[model samples]
Target: MASNNTPVSAQQPTMRRVLKMSEDEIKKQIRSTHNQTKQKLDFDPFYLFDVVKNILNPSIIVVDNIVQGKAKDMEKGNQGESSPKACFIPPCMLKRLSYEMACKVPGEEIAYETTISILRNVLSSYPWHVKAVLTLASFALDYGEFSHLADQIDSSDQLTKSLGILKQVPIVLGRQGVEKYKNSFGKLNTLIKLTLDVVECVVELEKRIDGNNTKDVPELSLAIENMSIDVFWTIITVVDCMSRICALINDKNNTQELLPFTGKITSILKSLTDQIAVCDRQIAEIKAYLKFKRDLESLQDIVEFFKKLIFVEESHNLQQATISNNELSKKTEGLRKKKVLLFFSDFDISEKVVSILKPICEEESRKDQYEIVWIPIVKNWTDIVQSKCKVNEKYFWYVVRQFSSVLGIKYVKEQWGFKDKPIVVVLSSEAKVEHKDAFHMIQTWGIEAYPFTFERERELRNREDWFGSTIDFIPDVLTWMKEEKYIFLYGGEETWIKKFEDEATKVTNDPDISSEEISIKLFNVGKTCKAKDYLGIFLKNLNKLFFSKSQKETELDTKTKEIQMLLSYMNDGEGWVVLCKGHKLVFSGNGTKVVMALKSINDGKQGLHKSTEIQVLLKQRYNEIILPVTCCKFTANTNSGWVHGDCAKCPECSQIMEMIINFKCCHKGHPTKAVP
Candidate 1:
């Protein structure tokens, strides 16, 4: 019954000495009991508290009803019958513990140290929370029964009056009723609640620790150390409450005699409440740390998978290669659950590959779904290597920090089919190879080739609508299509491009050939034009149609035929032109023929006001045109695996064309030119 008025520190030295001795003695009893038992005594302290909580803290509502002369009404409403959750502790064990604690609760005056010593010996074999629970329960039994009989002691029933008098409930309550001792009852009830809270925190701490090693967590270890003292004080408070109640029942006015014990219990309650908060924080921190550790382990597993995929020899210095960029390891976590593009190249990474991926990586909507790691194959990390890496950094929109030389050139060539040219190898989250060389697909579709698997490539091929798919990404073309304007896409060398642009401008502006209904837009989409990325994608897609593994010339579908026609015009290194109206192909021909056809249409037709009339005349003129013979060689990387056909039809004249294979090797900084 410790009160707020008496501080624990202000106690006399003699009392302090006695408390120190009591603490040591109590610990000895606990250890001796543990050794004698040799096994943990199982009990449900929380369930035991629930069974006796109301008994220890009688309802204020019931007291109010009794004072209002409505005791019968209250009794009728409260049949006192309740079905609590099943208790796991054995009935025999509970009864025995109750008897032991009841016996330990002294009736007459005794020293605080002696009372605690006697109670500790009784509860020595039990856990700290269980000991506190049992003591409170023992007091609850007597106190509850006393209150019940006292409430109905005035009844005509002789049995009730006799029991109330036998337990001295009448004297305890006084002529003024139990309200006369409300202060004492309140103090006892608060102490009981504080004791339960301490028990709950201790139980939670033990559950958190379980059988895990607390050595790594200093907070958990320190909280465990403080628990022993916290539990000891809790048991002391419970025993004092029992004594205080006994004093109240024996003689109401004699409660003053137990003031010192009450004050001690009150102080113990405050101290225990404060310590519970500390324990809670310690447990919380441990939980957070454990969660973080698990997450880190998951990320490390991914890093190791990447290392195994690229690192050829176990003796190779992974730390040196990866740690060169500290951000490499930190950002690897982003690769989890994402398709990773392992960009493998020599010191010279082709601008084609970077340009294709640059816009894809910088796309705000879908960038997070994939990651790219550049694995530069080099003999050693010399100044040349460092310089190359720095130069490539600006081009790499999403620069993955892991640029290591562990993936030697020979390994990439043998294992991944990477030739002198750079290749993008797409890997699924599990590190399984999805696409060996996804560069072709990426070059064709950009971000649409996400996951960059062969399956995705096939899916794009299956859904190909050449005219629509080609210009679907161009907003201006889409608008022109909606307006039913004639759209022309032309590509070529600089000289051919200039001639095509001049002829297209003359046809659109000249009043003699131009029609108000036939609106025309000409785009310069040459390999060296501002929109080279667009031309590159269109060429890669056209190549797929020409050299598709699943289809031949006779088996070629309508879309394939259309794409082959465009490819034929560009294969000779000549300018090419394609005309469409609202996703419908109007005409496609060699750039030279297209320019000549436009000029012919302009010279012959004057004030042509109909689009159909202009289209029919333009097609006739284009068909009648021919240019000088030139090389129609279609050069492609044989390593890309997309090239399948050795022969292809000339879509312009429907003639079979021969395919040639050539090979040449050169040292760094020198590239061999093909002999015409």
Candidate 2:
């Protein structure tokens, strides 16, 4: 007996050691023992509820603590610690946990009630935790569990309690709260879909009740009606808040400062809420009207029907008229201009008119002067027929109809006496007819003659003596070029030079001018050459010519000024029609002018000094011609081909050369062998 007691005393130390072990270690040991037994804990319907209540409840408490400002001390305590400050269960995690719990005990009322209670606690404490509440609600609704809860909420007392919780949600969460938890909620599609499902369900139930006897379970029907309205408004509020928040988030300038602009956002939300309230009132009125229609009182029902019919018709007509008026005002405002040139024509004539008018109309300087309104005289029968058939068309004649209606085409036609298909009616700034003969002007002088015609008409109206050809002579280019001594033809096209040379040869070979006295120099100004530099030189010489005249007391005549004006145009670098020592420009052409000028010089009608003019002409032409020749084609070689130039010397020899091509020769005043 003494030996057995000694062994029992030894077991006391082992038992004390087991008692000293931590609770976690003890639980691990029990779990290990339980696993070894190969036995399972029987499934309990309340197991999920227990799990949520134990595991998720603490997280909700922490969230509540944070929302209530009670966790600040804890946050400060763990600020510098290497360990994590506090347990942070994200709203998404909370949502997932709630969903799992709901899924586990799907059909259990106690499970659903527990979930709702937990979610309500979380929401009430931290009202911005909208995602968690929505998630729990979605789980219940999706699983058909909410319908069970709805059925159980039979008494008005139960319904009112439930409504109380729902009512607080919108008040506490508000628009800002919804915006705060939007990201945590992820896509709102699921929430919106759940809301729609609930609303649809309530609607279907109401329809079924209305289809059958409505008196039975009147409380349930009333409760469902209230639920539908509340749920519908909730959906609207959520969607509106989310949409506004998303818009703000998308704005680059507002994204970082969304919180700072809360006041503005709140104002916008208030406006939206007011609009929703209006919709709610409208819905209630519609529901009342529908109920009134179903009432058994036949006389009252008929009276109500007539009232609704009249109201609907009046609303529709008023809305349509308002829209039409707005559109008409916009069109009228857009078409209103200071001055307009309204042209009316058939399709073919309109196309022709547009082609002619496009150039003048597109000029930037003319934009502010007047507006062009083209109206096709042809009726758009195709568009009219299509419009009757409910098909859309944008035919040119449709625009004509619109304009004709807007501007009173009949009155305009009568006032302007425009009986012709193609006619132009110019309206003044006051929309009064200023010119009715615009079509004739366009036909006579083309679109370029517009505004000029208008100006001329103004002058006529004022009874001012027409400034007949502003400055006397338009200076016949032929007469001006003939007076010049030299003819310098500059052009990029070799064909131009060839034509001129052929014509010049004809002119030189005439009995009046000796072939020996003729001189022709060719310059190939290729595409790469700076033709502008030559233009600049011409401009500088013209400036000198103008200033030289100022030195003389006698003022230049109209012809001389016209000639100078013509010369000023040569700076365009199109082609030079230089004359009289290459200092003057008569005009630009494909050297046709030069050939004519040369012919005229030989004709001796202008009384030009032949010897002095020819000498100065040859000197200037040769000097100006050398620059392009040296830059483009000239190379130092005696075998270079000769060109036609009588009395021209070879650079290598003092002997008079003939057929000197680009001043190149055989070095002995003979043409190269390469020359034909």
Candidate 3:
């Protein structure tokens, strides 16, 4: 059966070729070779023409009928539906015709020209088929046999022409077709992947040419280089066209799910554009190296200025004498022709005050005739006694001298007679005060009041209500006490102290009152009382009295318990004991008197217990008690010393408590001494 089909298949191409010839030639060919055979077969000369006509132009109804028949067959057989077969000239015939057409044109240029022509027809005639055809072409350019054909042609010019054809695809498809393409699952994705594959092929070819070491093919190398650049740019253009189609879909459809993919494509485009820019910049730099050097030098100078502005040190250390007054004076001597502005404040208020003044100082410093100085005052011993001081002097100095001349901070307080902090003084170049109310001038006129002279001062002073107090004396004594943990009780009397103590004890002993609840209630009460001036002051005083009395009682009770426990086991001893009464300390040799003194101090300010006098007594007693203990003929135990644990017993009291020491007793029957 296969042998029987071979002769019939062999005759089909010959018959088609004869049919394609002119009528005269076709009849002549039939007469010359197949005359006897044709007579035996009874073949008509016009029969081939009929077949050719049918192949060239089939009926639309016949095509529709065939599609319907296939659909029915698909349903009956449960097989997948295929594309409707072409009723006109078949794809194989068209491909054969394309080859014949290429042979007619001269050179390899026909291959690229044919590709562009086919692309144009496909893009114009069939919008839906465009992506599929372009995708196939891209894949062919990547890995198919067409890649060799592409390589043979002058890629730079021919590929660019092919690219121009590809570019028209989106335009011909229009917005509606783009919308459909994007909505179709995996369509846009397939296109992007295919385009990227084409790009990769071009890049690989470029790499191969670059890696080739043979010196014989310089022209080929140069041509490949130009081709690669053109191909790269063409691919960029193709990518841009595809991206616009995707963007159109996104705009028309407004689909959120596609956003991630769209964003990725956008980022790829941006990265590609940036790479091109970098290449361009490198080329420009090569061409104009001296110009680039000059620009770079200017850029470096600008960068340095910014670095100094942003990263300059702003911290000032009070303990290390930030800047001496004499140094400030020396600095000012050079600025004698310039107007000076001095700002003074303690650390707390200085932060806010400087924020307002620093900008003005910076602006004024730009003028050659103006000089700005910051004077941070160390008002009290407590300020210095703190473990550390934070001074953002770098920020201040940067602002002061960023554009012009200015003196640094001068740590002077009493010498300048600054009673109130956050004061600003405007001075003449001769070290004479120009405007005493410099702060007020800044407040009223802002930065416009720079170089504040005596006239401006007089105008402000005259407008000021001298009799009316400009100062606001809102004393936040309670807030101060709370923050500082210092309870100051006014009118310290025995009755008042007892009354406060009773009230405090009553509140403390209340089992229902939690510590948190007590704090909240106290805060609310303070808030309410603060609204009333007289009541707030009275309440603050009362609170201090109550707290002091309660705290002292607590300390006295704890000390009494400890002393009683120690005294129980003691036979005889003369030793000084330190005791606390609120924040005050008391020292005495007589244990009984020490207990009495604590009560007296807690009772009221009776002038019976003086801190200085008690301190002196403590020194004398310490010398008498501790000096003897040090000289005593007792062998110190090296094996055991102080053990701060629950199991250890107190040596003096013989009570289960933390063991302080393990000293051998020289005097038998004497109680061992322990330091609390």
- Candidate that scores best on lDDT: 1
**Candidate 3, residues 376-493: lDDT per residue as tens digits?**
4443425442222234555444222221101112112222334434567665555556665466456544575566765754343333221011111124433433343212221223
TM-score to native of every candidate shown:
0.38, 0.21, 0.20
Could you arrange the candidates by lDDT from highest to lowest? 1, 2, 3
Looking at model 2, report the run of 10 residues with the lowest lDDT sum: 628-637
* Model 2 Cα lDDT, one tens digit per residue, 485-555: 33434443556556656655554455434533533333332224333444333333334333333333266
The lDDT of each candidate is: 0.58, 0.36, 0.34
Candidate 3, residue 104: lDDT: 24
Tell me the tens digit of each residue's lDDT in model 1 across 481-530.
77877878888788888888887888878664343645788765554545
TM-score, candidate 2, is: 0.21
What C-alpha lDDT does candidate 1 achieve relative to the native structure?
Answer: 0.58
Can you tell me which runs of candidate 3 are displaced by over 4 Å? 1-146, 153-608, 613-676
Clashes of each: 9, 4, 3
